[model samples]
Structures are given as C-alpha cells and as structure tokens.
Target: MPTVLVTGASRGLGREFVRQYAAAGWQVIACARNPDTMGDLASDSTVLQKLDLLDPATITALANALVDRPIDILLNNAGTMGSQSFAKHGLNVQRFGQSDYADWEHLFQVNVLGPMRMAEAFVEHVAASKRKVIVTLTSMVGSMATNAAGGLYAYRSSKAAANAIMKSMSIDLAARGIIATPIHPGWAKTEMGGPNAPLNPVDAVAGVRRVIDGLTPEKAGRFWQFDGTEMPW
Candidate 1:
C-alpha cells in the first residue's frame, strides 16, 4: 500500500485527509499534537503519532523512527492562524496599527518555520517512495498580487513566507526527484474558516487530493488551488 504522512491530523482538513486516505487503503502515518485526542483516527491500518510543531525533538524523533520507511507523501498541514485574539472566527482586517507583534512571531514559527523543518526531516523518506511528493498547506492570502483587501498582517505574511520557503525547496530538492508545492484549500468550513465558509472540509480535502494526485515535476514550486488552478505567487 502507498504510505502517506500527514501532520495536524487532530481535526479539520487534516483529519479529513487522514480519513479519506486511510479508507482508500493507504497506509497513513497521522501526526497530531495530542495523538490520544484523535480517537476518530483509531483504525487498524493507521498509525497515530504525537507531534508538536513547536518542539524540534519530536520532529527529529519521528523522522528517526520512520527512517527506514518510504513515505509517498508528506503533508505539512500543521499551522496556526495566530493567537485567538481579534481573529478567532475569521481574520480581523483592521488598520495596520492593529498588528500583533507577538502573534506575528508565533504565526511565523508555526506556519512558516515548522513546515520547512518538516521537509528537512522527511525529504529522504519522500525521495525513497514510488510517488515522491511534499505538499504544504498555504493560503490564497499569501499571494501578494491577490492582496486586494489588505489586512491579516500576521497570518498573511507568514503564509507568504511559507510559499517562498516551499518554492526554494522545490528547486533545491529537485535533484532528489521530490516534488514540493504550496496549495490553498479554499474558504473551507473549519475552525479557522468559520461556519459560513463556502466550501466544506470534505469537499475541500477531496479537491486538494485530486490536485495532489495530478502533481508533476513541472508543477513543482507553483502555488495551486484546491480546484487545480494555478495560483499567482
């Protein structure tokens, strides 16, 4: 069976990805901050591993434990919108002065640095697989050309940095035959997207899976939408 390693599998789109991949007969290595909290992922076929993005030891440990295993895909889905202050339900697009510096630091650490570290740790595992792919969950707001509304300073900036990181990784890891790209899952209904989001987690996950399944080396480093459209960087 093809093996996939997914982060942030405790809930939301990550959870949906785990469920779908496992049900389809894929060997899933699901990582969450608290593995015990993910009772829904308790399947005989899925291996739930505890992963704290803020902790490097855990990341290194997971990589070492799976050193001999080939991972077809590594989904860097673990991230935060920022501290739940003014942007809990939806993003708070206030004036530039309303920026939270502390939240910005935290967001960058989680959304940008964490995935880069993940890629570093598991690049070999993905390279050894039959289908070598590394996918990072980015956002449309990360696109500078698409910044029409202007706001979400912390969240937007971090995602943009993440996009840049993945772009660099795509080129650097190409010799290893690994495809790396950033993807936007659309305005899905989740804790971050709020209740009235246009897309649901199931549909968004399905669409993203379709996009991932169709990825080619030529498409590496490009920003993509869940619907398979190429996004502007």
Candidate 2:
C-alpha cells in the first residue's frame, strides 16, 4: 500500500482526504494539532500524529520519527485565512485599509512557510518512495493574472507565495524524481468558504484526489484547479 502524509487532518478537506485515502487502502499519516479531535476517523490503516504548522519543533519531531518511512505523497493541506470568520464578516477584515499585520503574519506562517518547511523536512522520504509527489493546496485568489476583486490581501498574498514555492520546488527536486505542484480546491462550503458556497467538501476533495491521481512530471510546477483545469499564474 502507498503511504501518504497529510497535514491538517483534523477537519474539512484534510479529514475528507483521510477518509477517501484510507477507504482506498492507503496508509495514511493523518496529522493535526490535536490528534484527539480526529475522533472516529482513527482506523487500522490511519496513524494520527500531532502536528502544528506554526511550530518548527513539532514538524521536525514528526519528520524524525518517520525517518525510515518512504512517503509516496506529502500533502501540505494545513492553512489559515486569519482570525476573522469569513462566514460572518466576509472579506471585510481582509479588505484594503483593514490590514492587520499580526493576522497577516499568522497567515504567512501557516500558508507559505509551513509547506516550505514540510517539503524541506520530508524530501528524503518522498524521494525514496515509488511515487514521489508533493502537493500544496493553494487558492486561485493567489493568481496574479486572475485577481480582479483584490480584497483578501493577507490570505491571497500568502497563497501566492505558496504557489511560487511549489513552482520552485518542482524545479529544484526534479533530479530526485519528485513532482511538486499547487492545486486550488475551489470555493467549497467549509468553515472558510462560508455556508453559501456551491461545492461541498466531499466533491471538492474527490476532485482534488482525481487531480493528484493524474499528476505527472510534465504537469509539475503549474497551478491546477480541482476540476483538472490548469490555472493561470
């Protein structure tokens, strides 16, 4: 069975990924800040690990613990949109003239720096696997060519930085036969997407899994939507 290390496995898309992958007989390293919160998702095929993207020590510890393991896929799925609730306040808190440096810093820590740290720590594990792939869940709001509304400054910028990191990783890790890319999960009806969003977490995650299933060397370093469309930079 192929092994996958997934970050932010407590809820939302991360939880869904765990469910789908485990059901398909994959060995899943499901990581979350609080493993207890994973609840009934625990199974014989899943190993829950405590992980906090904000803390480098936790990341290093997990990487060290799994040093001998070969991870087929390193899924950087943990991220943040700041303290404000998008469901209630919408993008008002992230709008122009409302920028909070502290919140912005937190966003960058989780969305941008976290994935970079994960890639650096787990490069060996991925390279040693038969299917070496690194996937970061980014957003289309990060796309410079697609930006029109221009509101979510912090969240948008952090995802944009993440996209850049994935692109560079694809080039840098090519010698190791690792395929790295950023994928947009779309506006799903999750805690961040608000209740009115069209896509549900099940379908959204399913679509992303399809995209990951089809990843190839030629497809690395590009932005992709959940529906398999190539997104603009």
Candidate 3:
C-alpha cells in the first residue's frame, strides 16, 4: 500500500486528511502536536506520533523514527493563522503599522520553516517511495499577482514564503524525482476558515487528493487550487 505521512493530524483539515486517506486503505503515518486527543485517528493509522512543528526536537525524533520507512507523500499540513494576535481586530485587514512582529515570526516558523525542515528531513524517504510527492497547504492569499485587497499581512506573507520555498524545493529535488507543490485548499469551513466558508473539510480534501493524484514531475513547483486550477505565483 502507498504510505502518506501527514502533520497536524489532530483536528480540522489535517484530521480529515487522515480519515480519508486511512479509509482508502493507505498506510498512514498520522502526526499531531498532541496525539492524546486523536482518538479514532490513532486507532486507524499505521503509526501515530507527536510532531509539533514548533518543536525541533520532535521533528528530529519523528525523522529518526521514520528513517527506515518509505513515505509516498509528505503533507506539510500544520499551520497557524496568527489570528489570536489580530483577534481584537480581524484577519482580513489590519491597521497600517499595527501588525504584530511576534505573530509574523510565529506564522513564518510554522508555515514556512517547519515545512522546509520536513522536506529536508524526509526527502530521502519520499524519493524512495512509489509516488514521491511533497505537498504543502498554502493559500491564494499568497499569490502576489492576486493580492488586490492586500490586508492579511502576516498570513499572506507566510504563505507566500511557503510557496517560494516549495518552488525552490521542486527544482532542488527534481533530479531525485521528488515532486513538490504548494496547494490552496480553498475557503474550507474549518477552524481557520470559519463556519460561513463555502467548502467543507471532506470535499476540500477530496479535491486536494485528486490534484495530488494527477501530479507529475513536470507539474512540480506550481501553486494549485484544490479544484485543479493553477494559481498565480
């Protein structure tokens, strides 16, 4: 069976990815910051491990634990919206010069640095597997060409950085036959995506899986929407 390792598998879109992949008979390596709350997901996977993106030790340990295992797909799915810092205001827009630097740093750590670390650590594992794909969940807000409104300073910039890193990885890992892409999961109705959002986790994940299924080495480094449309920058 093909194996997928998903980070942030405790709740929301990450949890749904675990459920759908495991249900489809994939050998899943489900990871979460805290695995204690992952009841059914733990029982359903080939392995359950603690993988906090903020914690470098955990990243190193998880890499060590899976060193012998070939992972077909490594999903860098964990992220922070940095909404707590902007909670009193909102994420859509912030006052000029009022953005919190700490929140920006935090978002970059999880959304950019963490996934880059994952790719660095797991490149060998993925290259040895059947599919050989690395996917990070990014956003359309990251697109420089599409930034017409331009208000979500921290969230948007972090995702943009993520896209750039994945693009570089696509080129760097090409010879090794590893395909990397940053995917936009749409405005899914998850914790970050509020209840009024159009898509649900199930549908969103299904679309993303289809996109993943269709990826070839030729398609590496592109930003893609969940519905299979190519996104800008």
**TM-score for each candidate, following the candidate numbering:** 0.96, 0.98, 0.95
lDDT score for residue 73 of model 2: 95
lDDT of 3: 0.88
In model 3, residue pairs whose N, Cα or C atoms come closer than 3 Å (at least 3 residues apart or on different chains), thus clashing, are none
- Candidate 3 structure quality by residue, lDDT tens digits, 108-218: 999999999999988889988989999999998899999888588888889999999999999999999999999999888877787777899999999999999999998
Whole-model Cα lDDT per candidate? 0.90, 0.94, 0.88
CA-only RMSD, every prediction: 1.4, 0.9, 1.6
| Residue 80 error, candidate 1, Å | 0.8
- C-alpha lDDT of candidate 2 relative to the true structure: 0.94
**Better TM-score candidate (1, 2):** 2
Q: Which ranges in model 2 have alpha carbons more than 4 Å from their true place?
A: none
Please give me the total number of clashing residue pairs in predicted model 1: 0
* Best candidate (score: TM-score): 2
Give the range where candidate 2 is weakest over 10 consecutive residues by summed lDDT: 84-93
| Clashes by residue pair, model 1 | none
Tens digit of lDDT per residue, candidate 1, span 9-109?
99889999999999999999999999998877878879999898889899999999999799999999888887653334455553488777887898888
